[model samples]
Target: MGRQNRSRKRRDEMNKIKKARYDAKELIRLKKTLGLLDAEGNEIMKDIADVVDIKTAKEIKRDAKTREQQELIYEHQESLEKGQKVKVTNDKTGVEHVFNSKTLKDQYGNYPAWFKKKKTAKRLRKKQHSQTKNFKQAWTTVNVPL
Candidate 1:
């Protein structure tokens, strides 16, 4: 077979293997639900478990990249604490850039204009008339028939 055909055959075989595993798991679940799980099903499950696991190329690459990013971020944080130049990496582009912790205060300086202390809205209470008068005096001044 040609290279392309061989690769396609491999992919199809992988899909079939994945489907078979899924079907086995589903079967086990269904049997358990019906209280019919038996030694045969358990044996099949053990056989499936014994199969060697395969990690995809993309996932392996992603794990390598993540470890590298974590190292970069740690270095950056360490430098900031020691007041040194920090080598920071752009997560998306995987590009590294250096910045002096002492010199960089962001574009808006150390504190932005909008960075004031948070103040909550003042709640206005309902107005009570003649607030200065004592409770007894207030009633005495009010008009009432004997």
Candidate 2:
């Protein structure tokens, strides 16, 4: 009886692992169909890839709201002058907040966080260089005899 119970528990654990793997495969398939996955099966856009069929409609709506807010903040900062007043609106809540550049800086320390740290092409080039160098070093070491 003890051995039978242990086998049943093991079977249940295996079934759970199998189900999780199957679900992951299905998610990958759906992501591919939606063009969220690249040809190499890696996620092209992680944000979109994460919003699979399992995500609730409310979650998608919230994500859209956040993106819209970010865009509004960007536009406001672009058009802002030192003394000019800007009206920022929340599309989701329909609330409008007005602030000049001075006021914004006093309150938030920065206008748009996105514009504060813009990633340059140089940064990407350096990142690529480091990645390739690491890969080459790894390959050479692995192929070398002890």
Q: Indicate which candidate wins on TM-score.
A: 2
Between which residue pairs do clashes occur in model 2? none
Residue-wise C-alpha lDDT for candidate 1, range 59-101, written one tens digit per residue: 9877776765555445444544644566656588785656556
Q: Which stretches of candidate 1 lie over 4 Å from their true place?
A: 1-53, 83-146
lDDT per residue as tens, model 2, 16-118: 9999999999999988888888899887756744565577899987777676555544544554436666777768879565666543432344454334334
Q: What TM-score goes with each of the models?
A: 0.24, 0.29
* lDDT by candidate, in order shown: 0.50, 0.59
> Model 1: what TM-score?
0.24
List clash counts for every candidate, in order. Answer: 0, 0
